[model samples]
Target chain A: MTTNSSDFGPTNPPASMNSVGPPAGVPDSAAFRSAGPPARMPDPAVVPPTGQSAGPGAESEPAVSLQGVTKRYGDKYAIRDMNLKLPRGRVVGVLGPNGSGKSTMFRMLMGLSRPDVGEVKVLGRNPGWEANGSIAYLPDRARWYADHTVMRAFTWAQSLLPGFNLDSALRLAKFMNIDLDMRASAMSRGQEARLMLILCIARSVPLFLLDEPFSGIDVMSRERIIEGLIEHMSESERTVLISTHEIQEAESLFDTVVFLQDGGVVLAGDADELRAEYGSMYATMQKLYRG
Target chain B: MTTNDWQVEPARPPGMFWALIRHDIKLRRRRGVVLPRRWRMAYAIAAFVILMVSVTLEGPKAHFYLNAVWYFTFGYPFMTLGISAGRIKREWRNGTSGWWMSLSMPRWQLVLAKAISSFIRALMIYAGTYLAVSILGAYTLVLRGTFNAQTMGQFLLQGLEWNGLLVGAAPFMIAFGVLLAILSSSSARPLAPLMWVVIGGLWWGIFPIAGASNWFAVHGSGQSAAITITPAVFPAIFGSWVLASICLFLSIYLMRRFVDISQA
Candidate 1:
């Protein structure tokens, strides 16, 4: 089967969206220049500053919506009926204690696991949008083949992902002090984590899902990684989801914090608003969780 | 991609699935890091010793190759199931399984790679054993007499029969290993290979028991132990292979469709 759109059929989406979703309005220049029938390509040209992207201050519909999405394993429930609405261009932090379903939410969002019940919609589609290069996900236990060097890993990722920008990834890797020639097996924990983060952040995509990026990192390494991620989010219209138990460190980076407890969303809102109303975001989350 | 000779379905075309498979293979190849040189050498030495012992002890007759090939088939499957399952467990212990499952890779691709990799290993073992047996048989013929058509025919039949048997059960064995990898935690993963070996021994034991009784004919227990080269043997072996393939495919499909990849 054709991994890309061109080989599939005439009805396939144009080459612009073939490997990666064109950010906003880049045309199918690749196909046009390659000498192909323009009519056969599904137009991946960005939706020009119009349609949903152009409303003034008006709210856009959520790219991801979940209602009562629950996952149960025999008696224990990972998540229960979690009602969540994620619009375009917003970083949603999934905050919860261990076993509170933060990871489960990420899994469901990535289509790794189906909820026992409820609905999940990502970018007006199911979770398998990686094929369209619209979503990028970095899970908690980020891993790399130990035999390959950082450069090899980067090349492999780029080959599989349409929007994976190798140059940006390499630059990010260097910025993080990761030695490109070092094999993955020999890299320190901090170095491997940095490499994985760099790869995910450098991808030219709209949705970036990061699970526990700051968890289990030394303060110095943690700050560097967080700062690098912040740079990635410099664009105004990209969405990021970071799940973490290190609330104190991650709280400052997120615009919205979603508090989950007992597999259900206990509270969710603007971080500043919640902190202002409840004193400290961390304390408020603890109190809410304890109760 | 054209519809002229290959288009059998109207839905999305076959390109999507082929792309999926190719994508999986490429990723797998890239990620297939060679083991440390020491590990590779150790395995190679072990395989050579086993082949040598089996050939030398069994002689150059049909009996020798049959036993040698059987052991060879069993060895590769056992090692592959053990090693692959162990790797999966290691990922679980290191907390990487969740990350891998979340990679947007279809679950079937994961299982497919595991099975296909094992199949490739099996072919290697098969080829090595075949070459060793052929050489030994040739040596024996030169010492005793000249090559005979009847003797060669018997040898071929025996080899084919063993092949059919190996192919038939290969799928279930691999599937069982994957199922264990999914169900068991890292600490418990090593037990899966042992479970398979025990089950295999029991499976063999049943044949002897069936042969000792006439009433057990309905169980079809004789096929497991019956080594005779007959027309019926090949068909029975092929039929069994077909059945195993279907079961393996279904097991893989169900796993891809429903298994909770989020679990540790």
Candidate 2:
């Protein structure tokens, strides 16, 4: 296991549609290609045949739960029949292809859309319950009032949302070096991302959902955003769910990784356990996906 | 586990309505455009001069001035709707609905708060015009020496009717404005209010041409009129209210079901 850490290397891979060149550990070229793709056998230990998950409090309740979640637009299925349960207080990563319903799931959880069938819950409440200051969601594309300054945006948040605290927001603004009085439309993408993070973190809400938080930012800004996220996570009751394809940059931050294909969960488990079960995480993942 | 899977009790009660209003005001101040003080002062002066001119021209003296006050009463409610449209459109164009959604106040509460605020603003505008008219009326009465108990009573009755008309319509107007805010996301929204006004005007205009514009016909006291309610005065008032209620209901439903802050 000493060399196990080196198996996943440092080149930040773009998670956008197999856009990341193979990072490391796997054969870089055609020479060491496997004869056949790897098969994913169900792990008997993880899934008890009884079909009953360990209930709440014995282990904390799943931060999210879905049974038969399906999203369809007219005749086409945007997402189909997904069942999942994510436990509370862990950093869970959601990875999927572009059309794989990642945004749909997040939107449903945030009460933006209704699932055609089954039920979904966040922080033990249906999506509508999130209105009671329990969940903080950062969207893939963050937008603010055009005429609103960073300070004004924070003030607006503080006034309308019970969870938002201006003092914490200002501290975050100062730390990020954002000019509070500048209009939001004038901000660079990196600054907007950071501001979104700042607003989300300043809230006292227990569950945080970040959808594609690190896209289109320079390396230095990304690093700073990551650091702020870590700082925000310092509280024990906080649970963070980040959806991103940039596995290499964010892999270290996640305690668990979930892979969604075609609106169904293909793989989910403790990251460490997965690495131990298979010699290489990325290599095994790629092979399994290919198959 | 089948029927009653995982149910979370609603965590908070419907709080005081004022809390939502206060929050909304903060949001407006933060995200909204503030009319410059100088422009506001200039507008006030211009309105004052216009009211004076209309009163002089009408010559019924009290009646003419009352007409001016009536027009002024409509201004506040109209401005409430118009300005809200502008604010919401700006938010949509800039893509800020995501941030707005994260606030998580129940949709109904937000709607109710907005209605109350708009109503209150309408009252203020009416009050300003009421005072100005009252002053003008009193001075004109003093100058003519014809001021009497009957005239004062008439003024009181007219005031009651006018104020009642605005107050009754305030909720519908607020609801209509908020719906406009929601629907403004569609590109075809700018014409909505204009269409409403034009339709109303056409209805009233045609009624006069058809000879149904007389007072008896308007109050529903006459049956022999040619075009009783075709495109004119009757349907415009009640129709707008009905349409506004439906649109408001739709906006509330979408805010509750389809408003996703996570997309922000």
Candidate 3:
């Protein structure tokens, strides 16, 4: 087990100062120990049978859960024995560098790729089954048909996905300055990014998995896109998991944050709580990553 | 907010299937013509001119009609295979298959839709060519004062037989092409050449190994050769249908189990 000692800094801090100091309620080391290692965390000894209810106090199950999940390619581990639980009605930022298994995790959640071992559940059901309908995913790469116009794509989404809202999609596209008549193949990289965002945000699904949503767009456009996303998110009981490397730009949108390093979660907790402990979210993330 | 409030309504299979079919058609239409408009017009005009010249010169004979039957028998399937293979190659090249998978529809439905769309496309092209040739052939026969009930009935029957065989063999060819596209490594590059090579090798390897080389040689000789309607013909037709069904099932299985959108 690899313990990240730097994450065991604070539980409760003083009312005035914001620093990496020990706090009340739980011990600093105890929190890290309870959560187990960043990778290969031990699986739950007692797994309830399918269709059976979880134990007492576990009535509100997570929107997305992975227990002892490991995915490998050749001899290299993309992600290994990583356990994660994302609650509903929150925007959790999965901050990681390139090749940190962020996209792999998103693929597993969407059932675009399967894990080599262990269980992956989305909305209390296995992914790639009925759960696929409930999860609206925007992958890291552009997957739209090249010949389709924006309006055509919207029409297709409306036809295929029960949760898609054409009016909202058009509204979002208008806000993004994306022309409804422009061919998808003719669009620039930034325009394609905006188009994908509109497609994902217009869906009223339970879980939204966005992998690198703002990769190619400029900072100014990304801000606008993020604003549009936030407006739509406010109208629904949705859980969003955005895997991105642009931490400073998107930090304000996160209710909770998980910092992944080398395909392992090094630090994770509530954004404000970490902010209170380390003065700022950036500061906390920088400290954890650098350590 | 409650989790129930966020739950998405399940997508109906029938609705999803139709949507996929619609999307595939729209994609094909947007890609426009395989042959340019002027070229297609030129070909049609040339075909008409050739028919007129032939009728004005040598007149229509039974051999001319037999040649038409031969062309329909051998040429149609090869054309259909080429068109179906092109459809798969285009989908992979343009990333349309990946986009389709990202939708709410099941993977099997997506594969089935592709197969159906490919068949539809191939049938359209084959039907167009057949009608053009048949109309010209009939006109020549009419000019020669040979358009009798018996002759017309024979022509129609032969046309039906050729079309039936083509239709029976279409599903297998389409499914095989789609499977190759799904299993291909590169998204930007066309897999048709490699697929053709592999398929050609298999056909060559199977005929002699199955001791069917004599059967092939007889059928492949020419329209002038004496044709025999043996018991093997029925079994061959039945085998083609079975192979088509198996290929379709295998394509769907490979799509659901192994194909990944990210790879495409």
Candidate 4:
């Protein structure tokens, strides 16, 4: 995952283009270092000193921000010098292959793991603080208590998560054709996947992180889940980050795309802009990775 | 939908703690590892049967049964270690802990809830067995016309002392078990039986090293020595309680900072 500074030289561009590499006009020595949130975008929640309104150019803050964040396990870096910003009210696809640190990045954002050297902020606060209430996460694997029936699982969620909408969850469950009385352990892998999706969608959080949500499910179920997700996206001013290898299937759902390789972003931009410049997401991704 | 529809209220810490405690209790019961209803019933029946047999064999010697009960109660630490260890290991093996970590609750709260719930569950089981034995002992004393106020008072006092010792030892045992499960490989096979053996061997070794092997044998004697609550025992009781608190604190600290959900 280590690369010489020269390799990242010209590949980095200015933030105006939502470039994947370093921001423009910085010395090569500090190119990789995160220059904190752009000067134009002052945080709205941070009150200006007495009798002062924020500048007119102040832009809405990102839903998630990672600055010079590096998470290491033993001697190996899981996430190395990563800097990313995900804007609100958009569906961002985090495209990566296996062992590309997708899960590690997600864990850091969820506050399950801490960065060794940098800062991770979710919804304007440190990850795992009050930001937790604003994020709904569905992990790659089923994590429910196997002994619990679907109804019991819902009950547990309702009790713990303040934003969990029981009525919505029940409706979603019915739509998915899942029995509330069925034990979680008794469900097949595909059924379990659907159940998890239903649970995540039922939460009314501002940020949603779906990690490998479509993995191992049948094509038909995947389509249904995708449709459900799209419906949810349309109804709310929410941000979503879907990490997946099923890029082809999920590309259309994304408003933005981030391509990760060797624990660092190789490419990132608005999906429509990338489509205009590079034809299609699949083609763009293929060219980028194959290059 | 209104703008308020999307607003997510912050989760109250106490609500989260209670929810986790309820979830853990349900989990333990379903897994049948800690104070399952069926096991409770089975234990009650066994206790009754033991009382009946002991009464028939040795009339008016019901106090003898107290010795057996005390020894059995003393072994609760070993039981606590096995059950708590198994419960934690199962959570890791099944990935429930990862789910728990994903929730919008503080890490310390989760650990504290589990520890409190597990300790209470173990206490309930020990209390049930102790109560049954005490009832039988009192009935036999009444039958023998030896149930005087002074004798009854002494019996109650001894019961309280024994309970204090057992309670003092419980937290450390359960906390250590939880710590081991949290630290060990999730894929490792069940270590409950092996843990029991190891704990038993360690206790045996400690008895000889502490020069308390004779005292241990005397404590187990049913009829030879009368149980007493004396000033001499207060230091050991205080030390045991202090040790328990330290283990519990360590368990919660490690769980908050070091537990790796990715492994689960």
**Top candidate (lDDT):** 4
Q: Model-by-model lDDT, in order?
A: 0.58, 0.59, 0.65, 0.66
The 10-residue segment with the lowest total lDDT in model 3 chain B:
B215-224
Candidate 4: give the clashing pairs. Answer: none
Provide the clash count, candidate 2.
4
Q: Score chain B of each candidate by TM-score.
A: 0.55, 0.60, 0.71, 0.70
Instruction: Please tell me which model should have the higher TM-score, number 2 or number 3.
Output: 3
Give the residue spans of candidate 3 off by over 4 A: A1-59, A276-291, B1-14, B26-66, B69-92, B96-98, B138-157, B185-198, B205-232, B260-264
Indicate the docking level reached by candidate 3: acceptable
Q: Per-candidate DockQ versus the true complex?
A: 0.13, 0.23, 0.29, 0.26
Can you tell me the CAPRI class of model 1? Answer: incorrect
Report how far off residue A144 is in candidate 3 (Å): 1.1
TM-score of each: 0.67, 0.65, 0.76, 0.74
**Candidate 4 chain B: 10-residue stretch with minimal lDDT:** B212-221
Q: Kindly list the per-residue Cα lDDT of model 2 for residues A1-291, writing each as its tens digit.
A: 111113222243223212212322222223124323211111110111111233344134567877677887657676677667676656777776666678788878877667889788786677863443677788766665555689877866666555677888897788778898887667888888888888888877667888888878877788888887777666444557888766666666776666766666655667666566554456535644554
Q: What are the per-residue Cα lDDT tens digits for candidate 3 across B154-178?
A: 5555566556656766766776766
Q: Name the runs in model 4 displaced over 4 angstroms.
A: A1-60, A276-279, B1-14, B27-66, B131-164, B183-226, B229-231
Ranking by DockQ: 3, 4, 2, 1
Give lDDT tens digits, candidate 4, residues B158-255. 66667766776677777767656655633232543565576577678755643542322233344434464455455655665576566567656665
lDDT (0-100) at residue B85 of candidate 4? 68
Give lDDT: candidate 4, residue B4: 33
- Per model, the share of native interface contacts recovered reads 0.22, 0.32, 0.35, 0.33
